[model samples]
Target: MSHEFTVEAGLVIFSYDGRAQFGWLDLKTGAYHAESDGRCIPDAIGAIEFHSDVTH
Candidate 1:
């Protein structure tokens, strides 16, 4: 089984799967980012936020 959802934030759409995977597409640049091993969107969002904060 699989679970998925999509959220639009500004020019980007965040796509998430319940089975620890997700992807995001940037409407403007047509760029995207994807990864696995996330339990949920919030979990992955938190990790991305953390990574972004720490990296920059």
Candidate 2:
């Protein structure tokens, strides 16, 4: 998928109509609908951490 989305002043738009899928709207006057890959790790959790290739 082409995640070629761009934003002016670092702003983004996202929405969900409770239909089926979620999507991202770019600032280029275009709408990009993304699909669920349906592949997820069981028991996934969220956290606040920093990771990098060089430093943490």
Candidate 3:
């Protein structure tokens, strides 16, 4: 199964191989800011950190 979703600037995708990859998306334009390179948690964590910094 494959799926794609966005949480804030974070983009998460689950591929047919059952691997979850991470990337970034431009919030305003809703375009991809970065392509998924098989990264996972760390990329997501970075997005969360960025969001926290902006919201605080």
Candidate 4:
């Protein structure tokens, strides 16, 4: 599904209800890269760190 979107500065703004989020979209691959709050581990390094943490 495609959402209505726009580009401001360098970020792609998008939403379904007008309350939107900003991110960098790869036009060639349709990948959206956004800032993380450090809670999501999308890489091997992050997965390793999260796996090694005893407090989780």
lDDT of each: 0.34, 0.30, 0.40, 0.34
Better-scoring candidate (lDDT), 1 or 3: 3
Who wins the TM-score comparison?
A: 4
Alpha-carbon RMSD to native, per candidate: 14.6, 13.5, 12.9, 17.3
Per-residue lDDT of 1-56 in model 3, one digit per residue for the tens? Answer: 26543434444544445555445655584443335353233223222223212211
Q: Between prediction 2 and prediction 3, which has the larger TM-score?
A: 3
What are the TM-scores, per candidate, against the unseen true structure? 0.23, 0.22, 0.28, 0.31
lDDT string, candidate 2, 4-50, tens digits: 43432221223333233333333384434342443322222221222
Name the runs in model 1 displaced over 4 angstroms.
1-21, 35-56
Clashing pairs in model 4, backbone N/Cα/C closer than 3 A: none
- Cα lDDT of model 1 by residue, 1-56, tens digit: 16543433322224445332344544485444453431223423311221121211
> What is the clash count of model 1?
0
Q: Which stretches of candidate 4 lie over 4 Å from their true place?
A: 1-8, 37-56
